[model samples]
Target: MITRRRSHLRAWALLGALLGATGTAWPAEAHQARAQAPALCTSSREPALAARMSQDIAAALKDRDGTVSVAVHDPGRGLRCRLGDTRLYDSASIAKVLILQAVLGRAEELGRAPTRLEAQRMKAMITRSDNTAATDLWQKLSRARLNRVLREAGAQDTVLGHDRYWGLTRTTARDQLALLAAVSRRTQALDLMGQVVSSQAWGVTAGAPRTVKVHLKNGWLPRATHEWRVHSIGIARGTGTTGTAAVDYRLALLSHDNPTMRYGVRTLEGVALAVHRGLAGGTAARGFTPGHRISETPDGSVPSGAPGPLPPAPPHPPQEWGTFPGTVPPSRTARDRRRAPRRPRSRPSE
Candidate 1:
């Protein structure tokens, strides 16, 4: 299985490098005007808890050379730990989930089939990080609607500009967590994110344990600086019913302009490890307790038996500039084949 994964990685890597070398252009657009301005954060109950978490994160990130933002949402608590200013940081691929939410919301509003080609685009946006699809969805829903949805979802720091993937959207750790909490509740404002859990995009890959049911979205982008560093964000939802009943938790991280952490998958894995330990009992986490280990790779990288390849350039949304194999010439096949012309299963087979 590992060998097969290595092969898959190599193939994908080739596609990624080729796309990058060839230059798949993603243009920046102007920020859209929203129907109403977003509201500022007014309150949070877990301020003290959040402060401790922030201190821990700050210490852990002392020499990390990048800004780190973290938010934790347990059963009753919605707390965030932020080390840096609450200013918007580049969201990288994480923004795709927001774009996905907007796309799904539009689908719901239009009363159109969620399994249509456009819906497939939403899946691509989330699973594959297709920039063009994100852009298309952005256009379909309009910037105003996107901002309103995000604002209503409580992700105030998330602002969408016209920049292509890895460039346009900015978000803070606090806002990212707020968005995650909103999704967990299935609020009307965040109903679109429900599609992320129901979509079977994760099933296309391997490594995550069958016992774990993950509803997640990931994002990554390389820095334009000379170091050419990478930044990434991952949001996940899993229930203990799947495995390690104690593993139920929300994980989020923001690594700014990381020169050494170029591999998007590795970057996400690091964050996942910290969260898993915090939830599953680890000395690393000053507060959390220990649980069971379902699979070593908690960040939901390659599934079990999946081979590791040199990390490829960040995945681009369709139509946008960035490195995405499917959008490149010669390989007309979409990376997310499951989201082809037909509708896919609404849920993964249990």
Candidate 2:
């Protein structure tokens, strides 16, 4: 009986060993299975959708009347699409977004939301694109503070020059899009945008009855070449009352430096419409329409030919300067003035 018991015990021990080995191998097999599986972003849904959006954005710029650079970002899905180089455009009113950000951050640092009066001015700056309000806030915010905010917010390509000039501050559509995306997610950065929008005297971008929730800021520099440019960054959240859930579409458009002549408002309307159509899954317009119509030789302004490649462009203008809509001008730093005036540098005597 003892010998039979010992043999049975040995058989049970061997079986237990085999089971343990199989159990350990199961995890390895599972990991291999996962590795072999296609990544979802790379698989069926998102990649294709992103590609389509990219195609649509490119087509829209081609069909539009003037020069434009656009960027769309869907952060949740890790999608980014661009239709132009990263060079600057006249910020027009879009710099208002930065002003808004600066004010809120300052307010937050002081441990309070802006007062009723301050909030009112901020709203006017953002929604109405009022230049005076923008200037007031710009003076209050200062370049040093604004730079700190940009650095803190992880905005790499954005810079604030002296407030009262068009080219003083430089910002790109991609940078603007990134800011809006972060705000749409209700990040701390967005809290600043919301606080400023609360005081808008009038709203240009949020006018739709569907109430596309826009947390935006715009800039225009009209004092310079009668050209107008607009810079806006925002999320078009659906009108909650209408039962439309917010779609995650972030937009940044720099429209200026084109041959067209219409004001920034007209150009922005086209951009907003394009965004709305994209969200609705509609294709962009086929033929071109200048976002602005320029007059030629004071008579036949309809110069017809293939629109040339977009001109080499500069960053959008800042709010303080009343100049070209979206062009950032060179600064008059001491170094800037030290160079010879408009003349080629002479070679050293050989």
Candidates in order: C-alpha RMSD to true structure = 22.3, 22.8
Off-target runs (Cα >4 Å) in candidate 1 are 1-62, 77-80, 163-166, 185-212, 226-248, 263-268, 281-350
- Model 1, 84-201: lDDT tens digits are 3264565655666666666556667888756677767766566545566766666666678878878888776676755233234667766766666555554432333334432222
Best by TM-score: 2
- Taken over the whole model, the C-alpha lDDT of each candidate is 0.45, 0.50
Displacement of the residue 165 alpha carbon in candidate 1, Å:
6.3
The TM-score that candidate 2 achieves is 0.56
By lDDT, who's the top model here? 2
- The superposed Cα distance between candidate 2 and the true structure at residue 225, in angstroms, equals 6.6
lDDT of 1: 0.45
Q: Judged by lDDT against the true structure, how good is candidate 2?
A: 0.50
lDDT of 2 at 226: 25
Off by over 4 Å in 2: 1-45, 63-65, 182-212, 222-227, 239-246, 260-274, 280-350
